[model samples]
Target: MTDTLTDRPRGRQVDPAEFAYADELAFLAAYDEGPRPPGWQLTPRAVVTFIAGSGGTAVELPTKARRKGLPSRLVIGQKFVGDRAVVERCVVTLAGERGLLLVGEPGTAKSMLSELLSAAVCGTSRLVVQGTAGTTEDQLRYGWNYALLLAHGPSPEALVPSPILAAMRNGAVARVEEITRCLPEVQDALVSILSDRSIAVPELSGTTDATVHAVPGFALIATANLRDRGVSEMSAALKRRFNFETVGPIPDLAAEIALVRRQATSALARSSSTFAVDDAVLEVLVTAFRDLRAGRSVEGWDVDRPSTVMSTAEAVAVAVSLGLAATYFPGDRDVLSLVPGHLLGVVRKDDPADGAKLLGYWDGAVRRRAEDGARLWRQLWELRDALTD
Candidate 1:
């Protein structure tokens, strides 16, 4: 029950899930007076509600807890848009103190889901080890403080704890981001940390500090992009330790469009500006993105899928860009006209040859839609030069 908000921060460009949803967390904690795993701040059900939202319902707080200064009723806002069952499974895994691995394509919000779960379960998501090729065992375990080590000589005081080590001690969640990006050996450092729930310090043998035992609620959450499958294939032993969940792209086109609108508007609001991109313009933008990503148009026309991942996250970025252009330039050109160039940019990221694919898409799908007399598609069809090299 660490009040992570004890020291509220100010002027952060992007607030972590813990800080952003501090109120909702507090409400859920008090609202659910059920039994929770030791060291957890909220129950399993509360954690799900905190992530997926309360289905637009306002939960009423118990009178006993209400006197403690919580709201009588509050509507839980949905943070991550996905299956509630997926979130529920993640919560159950963490409740059992098992390592949870969120596997998904790039920009699928795997990291965001990890952060929210960690924040709700342990009251803080600050303990994290960003896995990369350069990440060393010392970063996941413990390293010696050079200055202290020189004076103390293998003493506990000289042992600098890594974020994972700190989490083990505090019984909080330790997040490993892009775990597959780390070398196989570096990644294997976690096997013992998860299985044995302890790290052995050979140098500090014959002392209590020699072995660090994980506290009651310690667990790990690792996120791997599906695209990084070969970068560092997780060892069978390591993979056995985690419950895997695959997060895919938004399934519904309308849901995807609404998500793009919401995220883009929030991003623009950070700068004290409105999302000036029109809804129809957003629809067109999202429609094109969906068609390109799926390799099939809404009307069943075949499209040449680009090598680049046309993720929902990228769509939000493009929407934000459109909003920014409209707000800053003030009608320098139709925002709709900028769609082709922006799409070309997204589709060209992985393969330069994807430019030809985009041009082919315009020649085929854009032409057909324009021929069918859709004004937006006709305008887009006229701007085919934007996709040319």
Candidate 2:
């Protein structure tokens, strides 16, 4: 809305997706001159493009928006590396003003997709309620300014609005991260909001602000991790009001590798460090992860998948760690040598049995690949001792 992010502060180590990708949002807005849902920033089609990208094609702006200052042609980069169809469903759900819920295994980027959707649809992703075991109903609804409440006594001036409340008032989308983390009773607070699209203020009864109604374009996006089975369950009433989309791990190995490399490079660049980890090393890291996650190697060898979810996000973190170690330590160790320990660390997250599974994976598929003489696998196999050592 303010044109670009140049006016925003550059002090933060990590900026929100909205601030980081302001140009893309602006260009996409001007690029597509089409009908949009009320209170929406970009058209549905452009919103999809903003998430899934243009499939490597450059798009030129229309004559009216084309100018010297703005670039005439720009390509939208794919932020979420998954099916475009999944993204399309999310857009359609929001356009219909339905509460959209993204469910997935831990670290599959469910939260990232939710943030991207909120930012593209409403131009801001800051309106969010992070759900935790200690999260209260007031967090999803509203609280009050204690000082003002005690001094002035339950007036509209004393009401402290939550992010969800602010989003409703502004007709913008709000995000709820780890929605299942909150207690079931606490989570039920959203039922009235999603179903009625209004929040009642009993304290302000008979006042002009007795109830807050949501504007036309308002919606809520929630993310729940599949691995969080015992945390809490969504009530049938609460579940019925929302559309659920499951975000899965990347199915394609090459795409997953590329994603890890790009994300690790981006993360390293943020710290003014170089991504010195090799492509071969990255391929080995990702392939092992994929194999372990699926409980089978690409060659059909049996593997014991760990209790842990070998998520792509974790792979990126491991890649970034290797890059940082290589950049900072320099010549002390080969990046590939760090792979097994990292894999062990990722596997050990859930159970101790996962470590034995990692060793078994080494004894089986890894040894076979080494015997077959694939150079990288042989190097990885040689580092099997690195796991327990």
Candidate 3:
């Protein structure tokens, strides 16, 4: 069944990507005349189209039996902004039922890509295990309800299946976020599941419920931060099970600016406020992010790169802050003046030395731009004390 915008309750804070794009997903599912892998909702080509968009081309729906209220043609909206090749490779990897691992710097949207893929392929992205240092084998495998376990003694009724196990049983995609954060042993729990396509329930070894087998379409998508690679490294055995893909920050300046503006404006709208941020202000925000993140101006002038990550996701956040400030405060402070302080907060996240790096950015890049007659940069340079104070 297709879900319409009106079908969803209003005043909700957030919606899953799958539900948000249900109509598009339904349209693609009907229009896709290609062969799909077993248990998948859409073909690999259609999944790619869903994530990267249909390039504004009209995808014709099935004429054999048109569902009421469904569109006869669809223009798939581009939800993800990155290399098309990267997404293609990810889709192919999942189709082969291999574990797909996305390793990248923070805020590169690795988790977002995983969610989109899972949603498109399986019709749900809820089967997830967030890996942390405290995550245990039980989270990746199964646990027991003490009350039920005491009474039932290792029966299936007493067992609580993990997301991984649930995905395996249902023939769906399962996600493990920050996989490297888990202890090596906890991470190793996946090695057996991926290799054997089944998990043994040792507690029920002598019973009929001793093993749970994965179905045909079952796959795993795991994400790890490149910045935390060595925090708790994955064992070679575990690494051999998955195809690794790296998701980088958005490359084009115009694309980055558009993304920041769109997301920030959406954030403001969610708060029941108008998006009053100007295009010029957004350009400054994106340009500053690009320059700081790359450690050089678009013209290639050298500057000190901060130890902390300066990703497009952070740029969107700062823009959102400025939008909200403009919405509520309304001239209590200048929008341009807030840039330096917001940037200071982003830069000084991990290392105190990052503050010096940001200051150097203001002194070098901002100063040069201001000298070149850029009004926004001049205003930002004037507020350099915001970082220091």
Candidate 4:
């Protein structure tokens, strides 16, 4: 039997999403009373509750069949902070065994949502193909176990199944991250697989090792960056197989700030340190990100937006960096002062001209806010020299 995630060593650096929330998952699975699709671990409704959270409401487990030592009440935690309608559409698509394509700017949590959905639906999220220019067709299909092929000659044991094939055979969800990064030809490999819901093995054809058909509940969740959408745009034939959903940045300032704080604090705690990032500092950071990302400030100032994507995920990262600096290098610098440098780092990616754009934002938005008597903006405006120097 496969070892449960809870069986892994405690000191491991990373925990799979399945393992990290094993208890919660187990509880939810026990309490999932709705009808489920074939080969699905949880019903469609249960899957939604798991990803979007259950609002801390207690779900009652079956009295007769509750596992020994299990809690009777399970409160599912909210993981993704986005539109409920969008998540519902994703769940419905997956239920129909259709491909789900999540396209958005960088750091919109598309990959995270995909992982969470896969985990909730199948109890495993590791069946993934990370798409890139270097990704080959073999990654989407299957490869030959050279040693076994040499000895047995195209036998079943000689075939090494890719994650996609494995998921298909087992009726599980398969995730392809950054699909647009793959060459167009390589991306096309998925077209046949999705349309036919099967993979043909020519090497083992005419024998028992021919085509592998997908069982019910098998689906594909792919993510593509909007910036790279045109790099190697997917063909029309492939696009027809998918239900496209656009994941955007968090729309609420308070919610975004809360997300950044929670994530940054958790990250800091992992290092055996406490989060000391002030609320005021985090507010400034998030405000800046939102303003720059939208190409305008909250006060209605026109700011030159950078070419680089400024996402909530990036704001979390900057907050985490500030927390780490305060924990390790306390008093060396003020957390507020570090904001400009971090924003510069985030905006100056890909294009050198973006740095100047960032500076322009500082001159317009930051200066105007300072003039409005906002102390945080005043401090940020004083640090405008940081961007130039």
Candidate 5:
């Protein structure tokens, strides 16, 4: 991996290149040949390869490091399951001087993609504003210390620039997570920032006429949840300024399972736990997730739907739990016993109807699959009584 971002800050300011899987991004940059926007590190095609794995292409490393290689943890299996064209559109939009709005249901990886994009482009993904009801116009534009305004008066030091402002000055991508969580007026703060391409500070005397124009590669990537539609829809004025992209759930079951396994395995390894979960049990867990998430079974068995968002993130956690149990307990104790308990944890969020849905899944898919003689699923079927109890 390239050491370009080693000197950057950690925590609140992580070198995007070093965030999680930096080697993949470094590899992408090494062979990248596509056009790069001013101040950007890699081409759009390289950015795409960073997020979507190389499919085992040999990524050469820089020779200077005494270690002569990348950190093992940096090797990650690609997770998103969709057409490459979708990711390409996102990359292209950012390469241009346009705002990219990623709208999706919870757990669709919209926010993750935004982070990866910023890291790949600017070598840092730290500039971010987490939108909430308390998010104000000041949070997006600029705010001042009341003490400073009262004493020394509104000067640049007294004026605390928001993440968006910092990104503008540095020509980096700024992320606004959960944009819909913010109130409508708060969300509208982006309108002028996008269209006018600058933020006017009227608080200062001489600088009242001055506006903060974004640097060449500066861009905004905001994520909103589709389930949050009624909470705060984007105003027409704001929508016009952004290139909107909708990220959907993983399209295929096998792809989803692979993602779950990779994520879960990493987590298990981190805790120093050795998992004994077999392929069959993994299939059962993923099968259940697919059925619940899609509101039906693989073989067309009907299942009741839960109100809780059945995101891939939740599936990964459930798989991790199963692996943990297999690691700690092992053998004849049975991993299926934990399945209902985990399913209940996922389904029993805020609604009682979700319980009914779990029961429906047990009856429709669990019973049928067990009778069809899938041994692992059959074990889970016998343990279905655990959900009710």
Candidate 6:
């Protein structure tokens, strides 16, 4: 098994399931005698509980005792808001030793999902390669330290192991973020790493074997943005080496609202600002987001969409501002007044075209809501002048 700790800490080493969601993961892992890949500490069921969270749903935990409180660090929450089946497929793919590529637009939480999965699967998300323009083949393979290579002449000491190499040696999951941002050649370097499941280091002669095969339970999870489509598309051969999973924007309104509310609190807490947005304001804001994002009003009226992507993340920002306003400026004034202003901040992206879309939303959704006897919404409609400027 991989050492779950580094040298610096000398204390009790609790398993991830026990520490993460003690009640949930413990129960799942206890009853979950499912087939586990080699070197994997938890069964696949335990891994799911770690990512999606136990959700207060009852599951039997292991009878083992080591520390106080729940088994795991419940602080790090289950972040992704999507289908559980998608996450299941991802876990299954990794267990099969296949590369899992998460493709999505910006602000879709692809990176976060990848991190959570890595953390749950192997108890650590540190093994990673941030793909960028300057990323090199050696980043995904192995590089040699010039000084050590010059002195010791290509030995293990001189060998600078990349994240992939470290993961291979330790059977940990490795993540490649913004993979399409890397140059085509650099991206192509993963082909051999995914297929052969090993890398050859010809430079480190006589140190060890030229090849380094992956230890059991080792896998690769890479994330790429669809916006990078024109940049450097993954080759057909490389595409074939991995299971492609696309993460779209959050689909459910209530779920999106809950997520926005949670993130808004965090943002306010970060700046020591109190959130002031009322439930009415949040509903309006999220409704606006869903309509604009889908390019149609809730009543099925066609509305022009801005070029800017209206994602759940942006809604959270709007909600945070509203919350801060409520906390700081307590008054009889309804918090719904800030909806138009925040909507401007979210929808008025890209260029003049986005401004036009905002105007269309004001003329359509806002106007229609006012006619439907929504007093709070009518007040917001009256405040539409704030968005125009």
Instruction: Return the top candidate by lDDT.
Output: 2
* Candidate 4 vs candidate 5, TM-score winner: 4
* lDDT tens readout by residue for model 2, 1-389: 23265765455667798998999998998889899999999999999999999989998898998866578899999999999999999999999999999998888999899999999999999999999999999999999999999998999889999999999999999999999999999889999899899999999999889999999889999999987857898889999999999999998999999899999999999889989998998999999999998999999999999999999999999999999999999999888888898899999998977799999999999999999999999998888878776
**TM-scores for every predicted model:** 0.95, 0.96, 0.95, 0.94, 0.88, 0.85
Regions of candidate 5 where Cα sits further than 4 Å from its true position: 1-17, 59-79, 328-332
User: How far out, in Å, is residue 342 in model 3?
Assistant: 0.3
Give each model's clash number.
Answer: 0, 0, 0, 0, 0, 18
Can you write out model 1's per-residue Cα lDDT over 2-46, one digit (the tens) per residue?
446786544666888889889899999999999999899999999
Lowest summed lDDT across 10 adjacent residues in model 1 is found at 1-10
Where's the lowest-lDDT run of ten residues in candidate 5? 9-18
Top candidate, metric TM-score: 2
lDDT of each: 0.91, 0.92, 0.91, 0.89, 0.80, 0.78
Q: Residue 136, candidate 4: how far off, in angstroms? A: 1.0
Residue pairs in collision within model 4: none
Candidate 3 residue-wise lDDT, 1-389, digit = tens: 23475675555566787998999988888888689998899999999999999887888887973789788888997888999999999999999999999999999889989999999999999999999999999999999999998886788999999999999999999999999999999999999999999999988998888999999999999999998999899999999999999999898999888878878877787878877988998999889888888888987888898888999889989998999899889989888888888888998898877899889988898899999999888898888888888
Error of 3 at 45 (Å): 0.8
Residue runs of model 1 more than 4 Å from their true location after superposition: 1-10
Predictions: Cα RMSD each: 3.9, 3.5, 3.5, 3.3, 5.2, 5.7
Q: Residue by residue across 106-215, what tens digits does model 4's lDDT show?
A: 99999999999999899899999999889999999999989988887998898899999999989999999999999999989899999999999988789866998988
Off by over 4 Å in 6: 1-34, 62-78, 270-276, 328-335
Candidate 6 matches the true fold with a TM-score of 0.85
lDDT of 2 at 314: 93
